[model samples]
Target: MPKMIFVNLPVRDLAASTTLYLALGGTLNPQFSGEQSSSIMFSDAIGVMLLTHAHYGVFTKRPIGDARRDSQVLLALSVDSRDAVDATLARAVAAGGRADPNPAQDHGFMFSRSVEDPDGYVWEIMWMDPAAIAGTPETA
Candidate 1:
């Protein structure tokens, strides 16, 4: 089986966070969801577990950091094309996320933009030319 990643996040509003992730093209995985948490699957291998503050605390004794006020980690999602990156950012904004929390990055072979979720978690949407990734020049 392929390896998978499940990013666990503490959210203030479970419903709102779930909605935002769905808008960004994730599907709800009810098998792993409950009143205290929602499992959003971006792909078969990538998932996000949105947990309520109280539930999240069950796993850690440390205080929950206010994502809106402090930096923890920057999550990144790579899309198929530059247009897809823009589309994802647009969806995030429409779903109540703040767009471009950081400056947009554009290199000839890559492009990226960021969106801050309602809880202040930042997700970087990016696209990179396949040729660049493969260390080859693009032939036009």
Candidate 2:
């Protein structure tokens, strides 16, 4: 069986956060969700567990930092093409995400853009050409 990844994040408002994630193309998984936490399935292999701050605290003794002020993680997603990367970023912004301050990258072989979720979590969208891996000496 293939390994699956579940990213757990602390959220201030469960409903709002769930809405945002849904808008960003995640499907709700009620089997693993509740009033205190929500399971947002991005794909068959990728699931994001959004836990309310209070519920999140139950899992850790340390205090949670405000992601808006401090970034602890950057989640990245790979798409099939350069256009897909841009399109996904656009969907994020349209869903109320903040665009990454850094400009999009166009290395011929790879292209990428980033957007910050409403909770201030960064999500990078990228696409890499298989041919570029072989053609680019820098990659070699």
Candidate 2 lDDT tens digits, 35-104: 9999999899999999998999899989898888887887888778988887787777877778875578
CA lDDT of 84 in candidate 2? 85
Q: TM-score of each candidate?
A: 0.94, 0.85
Q: What's the distance in Å from true for residue 18, model 1?
A: 0.5
| Collision count for each candidate, in order | 0, 0
How many angstroms is residue 18 displaced in model 2 relative to the true structure, after the best TM-score fit?
2.0
Off by over 4 Å in 1: 137-140
- The RMSD (Cα, Å) of candidate 2 is 2.9
Across 1-140, the per-residue lDDT of candidate 1 in tens digits comes to 99999999999999999989988889999999999999999999999999999999999999999889999998999899999999999998998889999999999799999999989999999999998888755553
Candidate 1's TM-score reads 0.94
Query: How much is 99 displaced in model 2, in angstroms?
Result: 1.3
C-alpha lDDT values of all predictions? 0.93, 0.85
